[model samples]
Target: MGVWIRPEVFPIFGAVGAVVGICSMQLIRNITTNPEVRVTKQNRAAGVLENFDEGEKYAQHTLRKFVRGRRPEVFPNMNKYFAEKQ
Candidate 1:
């Protein structure tokens, strides 16, 4: 069986969709592209450090795996510990 859309309503749907798409794109660009909505330099610096530590941890694991030619030890499943630690 085939579905049917009224030709008259199809254009209206397209017009509404275009308006919604434009508005959503504009909102996303305004939030992401504009600097005022972004994280401050201090916060970004902290984020950089956090990510660096995470990368270093992975690099260490890779070194252990290759240098010793052994499978890496699986890290224990830890509770989520970001921004929630005392």
Candidate 2:
């Protein structure tokens, strides 16, 4: 038995496949790059110890990623606007 897909619909199939692949890759990257996830995986593989500060440090997502990074502002000029108002 054989099935044939219309030529016009072939592009739609390719686009859907590309979108699915991109989404899956992004999901994997987010999980793998996460500090807490890494810490948990390490703890499991090496066996948990008394001092679990590694995971504790990354327990808070905002604290773990954003505190040391750039300011979480919507617009670049928003900070200036607030500062002048205050």
Candidate 3:
């Protein structure tokens, strides 16, 4: 008999390829449209790059920003370490 592949494998491959394609497209789009990457020497010399500020403020919104910036602690839940005894 000739070579035969199971039909079930086709959809799995298709789904994986679709996910990879979407992720790659998103990565490319982010790289191309990133404000920091597009900064020019002239803008830097002029002392005013609009894109720089936009880039800095890209994701400074809501709770995620605060959560990402929190200082790491060995025992985050041990508040008594810093608190004085009452």
Candidate 4:
């Protein structure tokens, strides 16, 4: 029984890896948002659960939306968090 990776499984493997990576990054982002998750023992923490859709709900109207911003837009404060504490 040599190592075996079925040809069809390659796409599935890539998809799963991408999903896991995105989720892990999101979780890390959520955790880093506020002091409560980092140090404070407060009951209520920062962060909101937002429900949104990509593009729009219909084709008749484009919904006049701007999807996909610059990479930096995803995590505006991530830079500060990673900055040295000097």
Ordered from best to worst lDDT, the candidate numbers read: 2, 3, 1, 4
lDDT of 2 by residue, 1-86 (tens): 12576677879999999999999986785676544444465556865355556455546556556666667677859888888998
Give the Cα error of residue 61 in candidate 4, in Å: 26
Q: How many Å off is the CA of 3 in candidate 4?
A: 5.9
| Candidate with better TM-score, 3 vs 4 | 3
TM-score, candidate 4, is 0.40
Query: How many clashing pairs in candidate 1?
Result: 0
Q: Clash pairs of candidate 2?
A: none
Worst 10 residues of 1 by lDDT: 75-84
Residue pairs with backbone overlap in model 3: none
Cα RMSD to the true fold for all candidates: 17.5, 8.1, 9.5, 17.2
Model 3, 83: alpha-carbon shift in Å?
Answer: 50
lDDT of 2 at 86: 81
Per-candidate TM-scores read 0.38, 0.39, 0.41, 0.40
Off by over 4 Å in 1: 1-5, 39-86
